[model samples]
Target: MPTSSPIPANEFERVLDLIELDLDYTAQHESFEDLVKLAARVAGTEISLLNLIDSFTQWTISRHGMDMEQMPREDTVCQFTIMESDFLEVKNLMLDERFREKSYVAGDAALRYYFGVPLKTPNGYSIGALCMLDRVEHTLTPEKVELLKIIADEIVARLIMVQAINNLKYDLNEAKEVKKRVAHDIRGPIGGIIGLAQLISQRGEKNKLDDVLQFIKLIQKSGTSLLELADEILNTDVKSIQAAPELTEHELNLLVFKDKLEKLYLPQAKNKSISFLVNINPENGVVPFPKNKLLQITGNLISNAMKFTPVNGKVTVDLDLELKDNAKNLHIVVRDTGVGLDVPKMEAILNGTAASTDGTSGEQGYGFGLPLVKHLVDGLNGTLTVQSALGQGAIFDIKLPFN
Candidate 1:
């Protein structure tokens, strides 16, 4: 009675796991099917398979002249093929001592001649085999065996290529999404600048001297904001910008916060003939925080106020300090008299679900400023409060604890 050789259970399982057979090979690809057909034609065999073995089963990713998709590993000659580095061949399965007792060899289908080229990966794992079988005994020429090895190499190359293509596709899609986000961030400031420029040009044409100077100032401020935003986008590294050495509270207090605020909001207020006021409580002078982050939070809030407030409206920014429960808190408030929000609009704006809308002077917005402010406030371990009524204007309050 003939008996089959022992299986290399450990090595087989390791190779199976490394290739990740199911993910790398699937019948959906026509290339695999074509490879099987070519193998059968070149080897002069009635049956051919691109086989992958996983533990207890031999799966045919692609097959020619076979109706079955899989079979027990114990019954298939391909199982023995995976254990060999080079191709395995049997001139007559029924005459071979190792395979004559195999059920398929003695029974109905009567698989006889066999030639299998082990599919080896670059990392040196023989995952499975590219095999050919016939019902009658036959000898494969040296040329035919070389052809089988060539086909196996092609199969492995194609699989690697597919993986590369999938990775490239994923990277391309990620790049597109980043581009959209950057563009969304950039559009708001640019739109505000353009609208302010148009206002300046119109005021100059009509000789509206009183507001013309204000519009010009606003254009300068918006232009500066736009330039800073461009720098941030180009660098694409917020951590690097925030990694600068921290400043003491007293040092930050003396760093011209009032001047920065005036430069940011005064022009926008003047462009619309709106009253703009900034009151800093001198006693609540310095607080330790990242200057860039604080500037972003305040700048975005003030810019938003300028965008939403109407002509002859009022926008007030107040900075003060409060001692509560022995913990000092910095309170920043921006209040604007303009079209106010209802409940849903306020929620969407805070939650980043709101779509950007044009401001009172046909100004364009990307609806990203408030969400960015919300993110910054969260990072600072602060609280944000919004109070508004339809046509009654709105107020944004932020409270941050001193470090």
Candidate 2:
């Protein structure tokens, strides 16, 4: 029997969870078809179906002696099956007022008998049903009913396995993306290390020992950053690819970040005869945020800006703190005076769909930089916006909240 309420209390959430499984609604699998066939045989019925019910549609994933694949929810007896915590058996559909008006009952199919058991999820939501149907009234013995219950449980188990497989596939894809991101992110730090090493080599006789030691310290920091990022992405023990790194409170030193950025891009800027500037509000000497993630975000943005800006152009980075709702928020703006982005490219970059484009210096790319920046910003519960025209310039504006 159906419950008094027309819809289940958790109907919306249950349906959404079902949809996320990404099941194939059609009855195409041989195993599913066999189970439905066995179900019909055990009940001595002419028809059977494995049906998943959403809010408005009953999707038949498997069937026996039927050509149909789906029906309106109002036309499905399985709708009542899902509503029930257990089996729903209407021995004579024509005699039940609730089902008498259904098209399958009153129309050409003329279905009269139905015996269904809810296919329960691990969380106890009845997402669908496995049922046997007939054109004439039929009865099930106690022993046959017990067999049907076992088969229904089997169907539920297989559905769960399907969901697990789907999730594993998604995880594997995420892992691949993480690898690409790691490779893309490590490039900047590695480049900094190489450049700093060259500077030390060139200044061996001319530079003071203290200056050489400073460059060595910079090289060590760059190498440490490179290693940290690689470890974070490669270490799957914490499921880091799926989880954002924990945010820190007043741990990010703005001064160190500013120094690192200048050390990284100053060489490149000078090589191209460009003016590069980094500005951090003195009031925000330290802020609450994940230092590594912030570095990754800003580093990627600066790298992109430097790559696209033509020789002799100017690139400026501004960082400030804002007080909103008594919480500290960080604002980052990276502005470049070079070849800017058009509408389509900007759209694609922001949406993570853009492919790699060559910079003014013909520097190649894997098209991962901006997309990775967008991802990191989103994981921080931050917002990123871009303003640009084809030839004028581009500005990337980011806002990140602090706990």
lDDT of 2 by residue, 1-403 (tens): 3322256677655664564454544323575877888999999999989888754446677888877666545456787788787699998988898888767888998999999999887777888899999998887999999899899999988887766775676556556657667667888998999999888788779988899889889999998888888777666433222322322221355665677678645766786678999999877555433343675577668778877899989999998877554366888999999899999988997897777776787654435568767876887799999999989889999999864
Taken over the whole model, the C-alpha lDDT of each candidate is 0.70, 0.75
The number of clashing residue pairs in model 2 is 2
Off by over 4 Å in 1: 1-24, 95-103, 183-185, 205-403
| lDDT of each residue in 1-403, candidate 1, tens digit only | 5343335545533443433322322223365888889999999999988887643345676889866455545567877887787888888998887778766688787898899998877767776789898898767889988998999999888776765665576556546545765677768878887898777767566767767778778878878887887787676522211122344221244235666667545655775688988888876454333243565577667767877888888889888777544355778899999888899988986785666666776554545567766766876788988999999999999998753
Clashes of each: 0, 2
lDDT of 1 at 215: 72
Give the range where candidate 2 is weakest over 10 consecutive residues by summed lDDT. Answer: 241-250
Residue 203 of model 1, lDDT score: 59
Runs in model 2 lying further than 4 Å from the true structure: 1-5, 9-31, 183-225, 231-403
| CA lDDT for candidate 2 | 0.75
Top of the candidates by TM-score: 1
Residue pairs with backbone overlap in model 1: none
